[model samples]
Target: MTHIRGEVLIRRPVEEVFDFVADQRNEPTYNPDMVFSERVSTGPIGVGSRFRAAVGSGRRPVEMRIEYTAFDRPHLIASTTTMAAAEFSGTLTFKSTPAGTVLRWSWQVRPKGALRLMGPVFGPIGSRREQRTWARLRDHLEAAAKPPLRPGPVPTRFRRAATSHPPAA
Candidate 1:
């Protein structure tokens, strides 16, 4: 078992952020690795809604088809991946703040087979990877919802640990 947790404050409204993130389809814009995203089933959002997303833009990221295990609008959204290699469950919660909306995402992943063995070596790496991913997503979302700070400049990548390290992103 491995855990990766992160929280970011976004200027976007709670509902806006919640809605955008609730749908996996919106990830490509923020998370650079997510080359494609789409819902696998019907309905805008609810329990049983399914989705499949491709992760790596460079080398075709592993795809995962997951179904919503539970949905509590404007607050909690939970889902589980159907892939045998990876079991991913995540929850997103929002709270209003003076600065903006506080968006918190906690992910618990159980990598099976070969990936499981790397847990000890990569657990910390994965944790930081997720944190960086979340930070990028948050910055991108806020930047998109609001306006650009200057003429043009992408948000800086957030990597707490060295990219050369293991746990291959």
Candidate 2:
């Protein structure tokens, strides 16, 4: 079994960050390796919710089914994932901080079938990839929190009109 853990601090409220991360549909936005991801089960997010995701690409693409095992609103979430090559479980914990929210993620992966023999070689690569994913997640969350920029400088006419007194009520 291989284990990987990482943490990131996002400049957003705990509820906002937790809700965004808990929704499986948001995976592609941050996880570049996720070719596609979507919820397979209906209804609100909670224990038992399931998601299907295709990671990587080409002939060796990995498809996985993720089932939510634990869901604690604005705090923690845990899930089990099964794929043709391996089985893994992951947990994410959210904590409120003065600056923002701190997100901690961990995963335990166990290779199955013929893949077990290569675990030692793949483990470190997987861990590094996960860390990069966390960095992307941080960038995504922080960028989303920023206000959008104005299209351009205000027109001179509009600027002058604002400074001028109204002609009448």
Candidate 3:
């Protein structure tokens, strides 16, 4: 069994970050390797929710089924992901900080098929991939939270009317 653990600090409110991560459909937006993800189960997103997703690209992408085992709004989430090559069970905890939110993950991975033979390398690769995935998530969420730039300068004619100094007429 391989274990992966890490934490990421996102510059966004705890509830906002939790909601975005709780929705499986949002995975593809941050994880480049996730080609597609859709919720398969019914009802609101919470415990027992299921999702089907595909990761990687090319002719034979790896398909995965994910299910949430535990959910606590803005605090904790636990899930399992099963794929042809491996299975993973994990928990992600969210903590509100003065700056924003802190998200930490701990996962246990079990390798199967040919991947089982690559025991020594699997942990490192998985660790790197998981780290990169969350880093992208942090960047994506923070960037989206930024206030949009003010509208470009108004047309000269439109600005003239609003300006305190009226054009010499």
Candidate 4:
């Protein structure tokens, strides 16, 4: 088994961060390696919710089925993913921080079939990938938290045009 861990402090409230991370549909937005992800189970997200994701690209893309095993809103979430030659289980814990929310994530991967022999080589690669994923997550969340810039005030002509036509009521 190989273990990978990473943490990030996102400048967003705990509930907002948790909600964003809990939804599998948001994976591709942060994870560059993920090609696409979608919820497979119906209804609100919680324990037992399932998702299917395609990661990587080209001919060797990996298809994974992920299932939520634990869900504690604004606190913790755990999930497991089954791939062709390996199984992955991960837990993400959220804590309120003075600055925002601290997200700590850890995962264990167990290789099967032919992957067992390559575990030594893949372990480090997986660890680096995990770290990069978290960094991207932080960047994405923080960027989203910033308010968009406003245009230097509406043009006088446009503003007057809007007020010129009173409500038809």
State which candidate has the highest lDDT.
3
lDDT string, candidate 2, 1-169, tens digits: 8887888888889999999989988989999889899898988999999999999867776899999999999999999999988898989999999999999988899999999998886678877887888788889988987899869989999999888977776
lDDT for position 28 in model 4: 96
The 10 consecutive residues of candidate 1 with the worst lDDT sum are 153-162
Superposed on all Cα atoms, model 2 deviates from the true structure by an RMSD in Å of 5.2
Winner by lDDT between candidate 3 and candidate 1:
3
Candidate 3 local lDDT, residue 101? 97
Against the reference, the lDDT scores of all candidates come to: 0.76, 0.90, 0.93, 0.91
Residue 135 of model 1 has an lDDT of 83
What TM-score, computed on C-alpha atoms, does each candidate reach? 0.78, 0.84, 0.87, 0.85
Tens digit of per-residue lDDT, candidate 1, span 122-164: 5587677767777887788777766556755443553434454
lDDT (Cα, tens digit) per residue for candidate 4, span 53-156 = 98985677899999999999989999999998899999999999989999998889999998899878767888788888878888898898799998798889
Candidate 2: deviation at residue 107, Å?
1.2
- Candidate 3: C-alpha RMSD after superposition: 4.2
List CA RMSD, all candidates: 14.6, 5.2, 4.2, 6.1
Candidate 2: worst-modelled 10 consecutive residues by lDDT: 118-127
Clash-forming residue pairs, model 3: none
Clashes in model 1: which pairs? 56-61
What lDDT would candidate 4 get against the real structure? 0.91
